[model samples]
Target: MTSDQYAAATRSPTDTDVERPADRSTEPAAIAVEGLTKRFGSGDDPVTAVDDVSLRIDPGSVVGLLGPNGAGKTTTIKSILGMVLPDAGTVRIQGVDVAEAPRQAYARVDAMLEGARNDYWRLTVRENLRYFATIGGVAPDSVADRHDRLLDQFGLAEKADVPVRNLSRGMKQKVSLASVLASDADVVFLDEPTLGLDVESSLTLRRELRRIVEERGLTAVISSHDMDVVEAVCDRVVIMNDGRIVADDTVANLRQGFETSAFRLTSPDLDADTLATVRDRFDVTDATTREGTTTLEVATDSDGFYELTALLRERNVTLASVATVEPDLEDVFVELTGENETGHDGGDSR
Candidate 1:
């Protein structure tokens, strides 16, 4: 069956505890992709860039789309934005289907794809903003007002008169973002926004994104490989592998799901006999001697951490310190996708 047919078959449950038709004009999500699939090349050599994928992004939420290289994150984003047509899928933006009404669907969103560079490179920054504002259907008299505000918001007021070609990479990115803001769309798609930015610039961009989402209730789908960036900005994350979603959860929930009472123990006097006793109860992964101190890394699947401590205590094992190891989104991603063993290859490393 085609992607749309699959979506139609698998209906989303309503809050009223009833199953409704997929195209029944329900409350529109900020962005929705149903059973999206895309393939490239031809015949026997065809590669499925994006497999059967379905996602619903609520309004006013910031979501991260994460995956390793060749995992179809970019393809999914592009298809949703109408930049690349999915072979079989239905893309809805604010209740409008792109397959049926591309213009109306795209009207609800403004996006910055991996290499989204606006035209008018010869025009100055301010001029380019004005040009895009006009294209976005802003009134002529309102252009200057919107232009000034975006310039200041994106910290481009100083370089308003500078030509786009003369702007730094970071500045160019800011300008692209400014154009999106000028469009006054309800949703934004940022694909690797901090791909090539320096530390300071990346932080600045992240702060701006947070401010934009909070101040305007703007929904966003950020596709990036940088786990730190996702952890810092996204409210929830959707992890994809081989064009399929492996995990979808809030950042906090994901961390909590993987949380374990793993402890790092250090001792000046090493005891092989004590180690043997501990191994019987704990899953000891690493033991090393460094600088006269033997470090033990132990992982526990149950509530035996206190027992382990008591066992050490009974043996007079010198416990230097005990701390719980908290899991982060990166850990969850690694555990779910098994990408760490193969080495992660995606947008940018954190």
Candidate 2:
């Protein structure tokens, strides 16, 4: 949906109270995509960008949309946002069907597309926030307190009067985020929100995003390649691959599903022959020796580990320590995708 549509749709008889459906508990999902399909290049060699994908996001929750390059994440997001017309299926925002009523559907939605590009470069940080609030059918003065809080929370209060173009990249990214939150939109789409931020800035953003969503009862869909950001901020994760969703669950569940197989073993009595025998019998992912102590990381289940320990005892190998390796989101992602993946989303623009 265009900015004009957003402004027009959100406008109501009372500007102070942004138009919102009542009783969210009984309303439809914050976002729902059913049987979504999109393809490019229609002839014989047509490229199916999204194939029969469906998703339902609950209200007041943060979801992470993750995928490697060419995984159709971009196309899927664009279709939901009404930027690209899908070949088939329906997209609804807060119970309003996008195809039936684009303006109403997008009225509750806002997006920050690339990093800091969402903000007007010539406008000051506070001005950008107020301008976006006005466009979302909110009077600037009505949300003046909110704008001030957002600027201060994002550490942009000092630069509130400075032009966005004069700020650093990280500061501009913060301004972009602040502008998105300035609006009264209930559902937000953030694509690579931490793209240009430093470590501290990223941390701050993650904390504030979770707080804002909880306090305002907002729903957020975050698309990012940064696993740490996703893990830190999202309540659920959806992984897409080959134009389809391959996995969807809580982060803890995803990691727990692939748990207890990887382990590290440290030994002080690993001789050359014993190490060779151990390597011959098991999958040794990493091996290192420092100051006469050898450490080996192996991937195996409990039974295989028992067998290895038996062999070590017979060969007079002394175990210094053993620890199980916990899988992180990145590890779970690689295991799910079955390959090392890198790059931006597929098609439909970055």
Candidate 3:
């Protein structure tokens, strides 16, 4: 099916509650930032929250914003949404300059920044949805229809009449997402959308976000600490550290670029001859022999695995198994930023 058709099929009921252009272009960028910068405090104590960051989010892509705590991801989002004024640089939403036309720029983008939630102690879940729908300019006749759909899609149908204050944290987060989906903006900014959610809920939300981006052609900018979340949901990721964009690449490319040939071996016994053979053949990072068993962790590239294996075989050493260790985003983050070392810690901007 076509992308638009897919989006329409999986669209939430409240999707029609907000105003959106019917002719979203495949090539048009939903948001763009050039030389974006934000500073805090006075001259001597001034801290740069965002440092000359430049990025362009495609019209219908899900881009993951990842970093350790205090990496300026939040500051970048705030600048894009006009929540925090930039000391310098420019932010444009759907071709509208945010600095020059804040309201018009933000009108095309709907966001759920950190600490932004849709909860009214006095209002029921349905009431809250309806209220947000109205505020988002959904027509009266469509509000209830959209509300029913969101309630069911988010698995909150049973709690429709229940007040928000009584719901659990996960349920509240679901409500907040439903509210944003109800807005139906072309571009959505999700700041820690899955934070504090259970595994099942997190999975559900990730699936929904993917569906939204792929089917509806919605552009999304997601800020998250969970590497697994970025791996599963984002097509590409931008890593930040010390208020700078350290890396930007597809997850697969990053994985392949950082692939390491590492192996773990276990054996019941190790003779002196076999130990000598192993040492001559492999650059062993660690070797431990205990309880009449030996285990070794060795690092090699693809071309060297065979030679290492051949040497072990020549010594009549018993081999359990050899496998390449897969590199994760966390490993790449550390390798690129060097943040794992001391004296280089940074905080996510408030």
Q: Who wins the lDDT comparison?
A: 2
Candidate 2 per-residue C-alpha lDDT over 1-350 given as tens digits, one digit per residue, 9 for 90 to 100 = 22233234334354444332234445579999999999998778989989999998889888999887778888899999999999999998988999999999998689988722698999999899999999999999999999999988899999999999999989988888899999899999998888779999999999998999899999999998888899999988998887888877678766655556878999999999999999999999999999999999998999999999999999999899999988888877887776454444422242
List the global CA lDDT of all models: 0.76, 0.85, 0.74
Candidate 2 TM-score, true structure as reference: 0.84
Clash count, predicted structure 1 = 0
Q: State which candidate, 1 or 3, has the greater TM-score.
A: 3
Off by over 4 Å in 1: 1-26, 118-120, 140-146, 264-320, 340-350
lDDT of 1 by residue, 1-350 (tens): 22233233334343235332244235578888899999988978988888899998888889999877777888888888877888998888887888899888877577777655654678988887777767777754675876787787777899999998898888887888777777667898887777667788788778877887888899999887677789889988898877888777678655655546577778875588888888877898788987778888887744677788788888888877666667667667766766652333434221
> Model 1 scores what on Cα lDDT?
0.76
Reference-based TM-score, model 1? 0.75
Return the TM-score for each candidate structure: 0.75, 0.84, 0.77
Q: Tell me the tens digit of each residue's lDDT in model 3 across 146-228.
A: 56766777789998888888988888888887777775578888877877789998988887778757766788888877677
* RMSD score of candidate 1 (Å): 6.9
